[model samples]
Target: MTDYGHDLAFGSFLTPSAGTPEQTVSLAMLCEQVGLDLVTFQDHPYQPGFLDTWTLLSVVAARTERVAVSANVLNLPLRPPAVLARSAASLDLLSGGRVELGLGAGAFWDAIEAMGGQRLTPADAVQALAEAIEIIRRIWDTDTRGGVRVDGDFHRVHGAKRGPAPAHDIGIWLGAYKPRMLQLTGRVADGWLPSLGYLADGDLAAGNLRIDEAAAAAGRSPSAVRRLLNVSGSFTGSGTGPLQGPAARWVDDLTRWALEDGISTFILGTDDPDDLRRFAAEVAPAVRELVAAERTAPVPAAPVPPAPVPAAGPAPLVQSRHAGTGFAVVPTPDDGVRRSSRRVWDEAARPTGPAPDPARRYTRQELVGGQHLIDIHDHLRAELAQVQDLVEQVAAGSLGVGAARSHLNTMTMRQNNWTLGTYCESYCRVVTTHHTIEDQSMLPHLERADPRLAPVVDRLQQEHLVIHEVLEGVDRALVALVSTPTGMDELRAAMDLLTDTLLSHLSYEERELVEPLARLGMH
Candidate 1:
């Protein structure tokens, strides 16, 4: 005898026709009234006709109780991995571990095309998905020490740490059907939610077979991975009795197919509160009673427990006073957790040309968590040293125009690296993620601890602007020449200019901070 449990979860999807916020909450209250196992809300970032799901859920979490809440699926690739993970943890912590993260290798082509974003091939999207998922979990691990540590072809997170792993470990659900993807599910995913097809038009058996094979490869029993699905709208209560009435019959059809396939979760989507209410009131109770009876009557010496149904209980976010986020910024490269990308070592590809290629120069990984800002600071330090050496030599008469030009090329690399890299990664990426951190985590601390150093910070920022202008000008005139081996003349001119301009800024900044820095030279 198999240990049986009748577990049912409910889904809420806001559509163009869905009611207002007040109405949605009213529907939620009724769901709690009906004892919904779990309530999942759909999220579509660019869903024009619907509300931004997270914002809505944030509000819902506060207003509702006794019902678990989450995005039916969150398009994770649309956001920075760290940002999404932090939000996931925050929701889970607040909800007492009731949050579920439903992810997919994004296929929202119209949305991507609208934003002018990188349109990924299927392979690329899956590659990104793998890295993104790892980044999410690494940030979650209780033992994660220091800044986040992850280095892979697609991403590098140097700074990350966040708190209060959800009361319920946030479950990961994959909304995919491909074979390689199913393998990923068996190996890593917490569950699989495949979409149901109508009649002979679709082939569910083939996909399930693929999943079974993948599970074997992943060293797991085929039944170990949780399986679920969305029932097609045409499922009428046509085949069964009152329990098989339009709604019950519809659910029974789904339940039978799911049980045979080792799928236990069924997400029945309906915008009508009444229709869902009927399922809860008329159908769900019957299933639970039957399931409980089966569990109690089981006699097999070795009974496999029925998969625990994902309970749709209490809204995860309601009635919590967590004003500030407990989730830390996911560790990124800037935090010095992971080694930089392999491309970092391939200096042969480093651009010494006039203008840097924005796309090639910066990977999507850097902009995600302020690693770009961190890198800009790093390159600035390196560039400053090179410029300082050239200036000191020139001032001492040990160097002339030829020496100046040679060093100037190195200056150009630094200047351009900062110019293109900073905007592409820092102000553009970091500020975009969490704007207040600039003023909160950084600027205020710099000012409060050392007001006298204010002038130097301003000067450094100003040098950033100057570097940009100079690099752009040099790129226009000398990009092609630097790519090749020779032309010391071109290098001499760039070097002379950068050494003069940048060394001056460094000297000024040093003068402003000399007193403070001298007090604790090594520290």
Candidate 2:
């Protein structure tokens, strides 16, 4: 029950059974107002009683602003990739990128067969699911020219381009239980969405063990694929769900299950309309309280991160930025060179950071399309080299007054012209993405693979916090300098303070991890 985004992942569903526009919107809105992490919708392909998931979600997307809209478990084999990609893209476009795809290979073979679709072998279904994902990603890459194309062993989808990607992160989740499907999930999904009871009978530990094993075989972190548990909205936890109980009690049980699974997201569904109401009114609050409480609590110090694995062959310098959400922190100049930066700040407050124009800042959706993730090796080498030189210079006491003044003058010039990308901007972009990948994706693996790395990782976490505060000070100074436009002295003072602190901090950090870096086969 280690703290692993339990607060962030606790989300539930609003089955489109009885939710009126007002009801669903009201519930979804209220959920976000209280910081409910996400909202999922159940997609029932053959169920006539339920509303079409696509139409219903578009309505929800228009109404809610912040909540992530996700598919509970979209059966992948049932839908063609081209069509599915288009539908998913449309939701992403409408929602501004708050859409997530929760897909499953589907257990309802008879259901599809009844609908006149072919009955799929389990192997075929999984293979089809794999091919579909490839095709869908391609469609996202290109425009809707000839639609989408999927020429695979199982299927060939041609043409299926959709416009306008999602505004925020559109994570893909795979619902898996068995080994093969779970393996596929590990290989292909942003998360492993499990179909399990919170406190089911007998030992479910076997599945957990296998999940970890399969994930390893795939050379992926079990954590790489987030764990999501789908459950009934009302939980009495007598092993029978929607058990008659007060909503608060049910929510508590749900949280308990989430913790057990090391999962934070719970996709809730119920037949009774009142169950949804009860969840929103009485239950959801208790869950959010726990979530908020957990978030505010101090994180346990993680061990030092293991050295990054060296790639055997030449890797792309930056894989399509579309490979993941948003941009990887580049070693590029952190100047406010991107015009959209300053424009954003001026509208809200005087330009504090380079990005003055808060009005035109790129959200995750817009940041997509050709940008790529900088390879971890390429990233570490440059940043480490930049930091190492400064650290050694400061350590040598040979960095005398002349050298200091020279460095300070150059920094001042960059600040004056607003053309210089300061350490502050570089640090912010680097940390925002760095923290996400390391703490969320990388740390877990390091902890398991090399216990030796624990202390180093702990120190890095401390560095992250210190750097964050330093950058905040940088932002404050930058804004003041811009508004008055004569604060070279102000700029000099800020840079001196930042540079001095950075030198001392990074020198110690470099010594601590330089060996690890070499061990990892990185420069």
Candidate 3:
């Protein structure tokens, strides 16, 4: 096994479609909301249909609070390294050090030439990229006393003053495939990014060997360079092919990659919101859990000489550890309070999951499965509070509609009631998407794993529908708030109803399903 011992990370790779600029930004924000570690966009600056990758990255960084942002493989031919370094450093500072650089050799010579960028042969392109990397690093080396200077065949920089260092040690990841480029990645780059689609059978192994050899030859540890793969596949009901199956299949495949091939980062190339959610909520955590288990699993001890039997007196009584005591996942309990007079479902009548067997022992990994559900719900709870706070600000006149609209315009959440409506709508979509995943994928899996959970699953599905209707009510109230002066009261009422229904349902679901999930697993 070639495990590099790096922490695994998951990210999203989105197309910078200028046609739906707002949606692109929204997807990036959703990456952060859904607990993804990074967000990336492809760069094709010559294409008129796509947004400028740098501009989109800046906007995404501004809008998202946690997720790191990067261009999948920025075209170096069109961007000068000295200036690119400064721009990256500036954005990294602004975004609180969440910027990564993914650079590439030039491609599409005709388009590059048309855009006033020099086109070169494959060998020349790789050379140019190496030269660019040197200049970029030199420009960022502000601690050095002298000005940055690099003179090469393709790029030349002399006496360029360097300062304004990045907020963090930004990784320079290269999208490399060819031998020379791969060698360069192993020698200097912090990461190696390659697309899975472009790789054939055994290609990943071969590439890893090459990179490792190059790293060793350059007096560097192979583990110094993190491996990242850009992946795309369908989510089917069963195993169809590699990465083309349910979330369980994804977990298995990615875990294998992490353990055997040393790929520490997996970036899903997708534009569909549902796929993004499933990848984040289902596949990512399970993969992390499994990889962690294997890495930490104890190695078999060498054969030890058996100790001589002592006095065969009374046989030592072996007491098995208590089972129920080890099940540490505690479900969040409902406070039995309601914010609104409106009631969606009769909570008292909800069906309970099958009782746990007192003899069944639970492992730490199994408990994490149940805790994962609560963690996701906690994120939703926090976001809902933010939405409510935004509404309150608007109601109190602390934030005027025009000013809110202008502020939200920068985020690109374009809607009639700019601030409150945009936020509420986003939250509503997240709730809807969460319910959809559970209904379609999670609940069905639970039903199959243990038929006794059928009734509980059925009740949860029903609650999901009721919650959907409540979300629609909130959306309608938002629309009214845009045109009617008396809409604030109605909006508040809708939010109160949503808050009550959502929290109660979430608590009940956790109470019913947490133990079962811990026992049976999320898949």
Which prediction has the highest TM-score against the true structure?
3
* Deviation from native of the Cα of residue 144 in model 1, angstroms: 3.1
Tens digit of lDDT per residue, candidate 1, span 358-385?
1222222222222223232334445544
Candidate 3 achieves a global lDDT of 0.83
Q: Quote the lDDT for 410 in model 1.
A: 36
Query: Which candidate, 1 or 3, would have the higher lDDT against the true structure?
Result: 3
User: What lDDT score is found at residue 228 in candidate 1?
Assistant: 64
Cα lDDT tens digits, model 3, 246-313, are: 77667768877887799999999999999999898778866775566566544333323333345655
Error of 2 at 71 (Å): 2.2
What ordering of candidates by lDDT runs from best to worst?
A: 3, 2, 1
For residues 166-280, what per-residue lDDT tens digits would candidate 2 score against the true structure? Answer: 4544678887776787677767677777655533553235555666777788787777667777666343424344334544346546545554555666665543445554554
lDDT of each: 0.51, 0.54, 0.83
Order of candidate numbers by TM-score, starting with the best:
3, 1, 2
Q: Assess the local accuracy of residue 384 in candidate 2 as a C-alpha lDDT between 0 and 100.
A: 38
Considering TM-score, which of the candidate structures 1 and 2 is the better prediction for this target? 1
Candidate 1: what lDDT?
0.51
Best by lDDT: 3
